[model samples]
Target: MPVPWPSGSICEAGVEQGIASKSRLVDVVLDESIGRSTPDVEHERAVAIFDLIEENRFCPVGDEGGGPYRLRLSLAESRLVFQVSREDGAAVVTHILSLTPFRRIVKDYFLICESYYQAIRSATPSQIEAIDMGRRGLHNEGSQTLMDRLAGKVEVDFDTARRLFTLICVLHWRG
Candidate 1:
């Protein structure tokens, strides 16, 4: 189930402080409106969420509330939405980013991922390693794009953005 978001100010204080209270995410939810994925993709999604929950640093800019935030990721219309809230589920912030910049990277990542998976089955060790390297490169590119998009809206480390990117790719899977 998705975390419920209440309508109100994102923070109790009007100032942008407490960004250093070790702000992080304790839970995450993907909107049910997003299409379902294949079994492999579902497994990847679960692992990413697990990894994210295990370790992540997420601080929303200008949020005075010291938090372990609960995040709800969803796609609305053509935009990706980041709905953040306090651990108690009070609305903290909502950031919406365009999918335009991610189109090419995501497409290429999908292609590389397919190749990597295929290589794992029959290709030689060297071939699989090569494909896997390319996949990791594309993954890095996508993660960097995500960080850039969320720059001022939310503060996150490379690893956190990478895991979030993985979830975003899951949401994009067609099969």
Candidate 2:
């Protein structure tokens, strides 16, 4: 199931629009409505990528002032980012932020996700299972072992792995 957002944590009117006619087009607006997110095109695509991992029992990602964040997916030519942290016995939904827009500064976000997926797809079932387990428990020893095993095999840095691991902790460690 999707994580339940905290009450009064939704920022509906705080959504900002990019300056008109800039070199980059960050046109999407994110707002809260009825306890769910109401994001524009760019944001919605990122959310969909986030949902992919969430549905698969992985940490749901979010964005937060460019701090250590999580990557939901790089699917369909887009990259979805989110802020992940733990608080109050539950995974805090801090902010759903984006990187340089997918099609704006870099248009190959989803392609990167696809590439990662394809590369991992060639692993054995046991390896795949291990990765799934690693994704779910990035903060634990077992997950660390799993990730370490797949480190050079996959295209992820320790920093990325660490962030993704923290994200899993915050996502699953909840009230």
Candidate 3:
């Protein structure tokens, strides 16, 4: 005879069975309070959201909630706010990160990105590649900084942090 399982048991069993625990952003909303951004910035935002949703690992530290979270990103009063929620629309955690720590890296990343874009249009192939390398290095540094800042609040892989960092830069542009 089969044993009867309690409510929510199946879900718990799935976790124990090594079924991947889903932890990701199902939806992202950028607050309109920051005002409109340039088309190029808008494109970067779209791409980052698309790439993040495609593959990411996001688990809120010290929270027992299941994944597929919804995120609302905004900047207010020199702070970056991460409004997180569950798939069912329940409030999860709201993390506010100061912008001071990210200012230098974000500014440098923007500068290198501009150089890389301009190089692609007029510079020689080798020159463009060299600029692109600097751009990538800056991007990595920004991503690592983001990961460090979010250390006790959320856990995300390097690529996830990179994409999130891009979005943060977009917010910073008009913030």
Candidate 4:
């Protein structure tokens, strides 16, 4: 099935051209952090992120980690917050982004993506068929606004960003 933008193709392309893509990074980290509780909690966090994405493609958008700054991820139409920072020698993603009343950029964009994602995932067999019918149908439609919102929300290091985007594409294309 056709996947969403910035999914597999974008990530693959990004890797070739040196861009920040999500899927690539997630795979590397998860591969490195699979079984044991190693010295790098960041790698573990990456695995957890993969788990979360697999379980639910939608998450709230907000300051998930809480401190002066906010770290977050966008899936579907929701923004998942992460208590992230570059310290020691790894990138840390802590906490799931929550639903807050405030209108933060990360959160808002995530919500949009989450909405589209939910609509796609919740589609029945008939609905899926309908969406697949034509270019303007659900499957063929694209969300530029969502993509615009997604801009900069994925600011993790190169590898992590690529991996995350890759996973997002997988979720979007899941049948």
Off by over 4 Å in 3: 1-21
Position 35, candidate 4: lDDT:
29
lDDT of 4 at 163: 36
Residue 31 error, candidate 1, Å: 1.6
lDDT of 2 by residue, 1-175 (tens): 2232223321111122321111111122222221232334344444534443333212222222221223222212222333233322233343332322212212232333344466585977776666555444423442354345433222222333444443332222212
The lDDT, on a scale of 0 to 1, for candidate 4 is 0.35
lDDT of candidate 3 over 1-175, digit per residue (tens): 2122223443334346553345667888888865677888677778878877776667676567576788888878878889999878899999999989888988898888788889888999999999988888988988899989988788776777888887887776652
User: Local error of candidate 3 at 156, Å?
Assistant: 0.6
Candidate 4 total steric clashes: 29
Q: Higher lDDT: candidate 2 or 4?
A: 4
Angstrom error of the Cα, residue 79, model 4: value is 6.0
Instruction: Give the per-residue lDDT digits (tens) of candidate 4, residues 1-175.
Output: 2132344432334435543222222222222112234445445455556654332212112323222222344332343334343323244455443323223433443445455556587878776555445322221122222333344443222233333433333322212
Over 4 Å off, model 2: 1-46, 49-119, 139-175
Clashing pairs in 1: none
lDDT of 3: 0.76
How many angstroms is residue 137 displaced in model 3 relative to the true structure, after the best TM-score fit? 0.5
- Global lDDT scores for all candidate models: 0.80, 0.31, 0.76, 0.35
TM-score versus the correct structure, for each prediction: 0.83, 0.21, 0.83, 0.25
- Candidate 4, residue 78: the lDDT equals 47
> For candidate 4, which ten residues in a row score worst on lDDT?
24-33
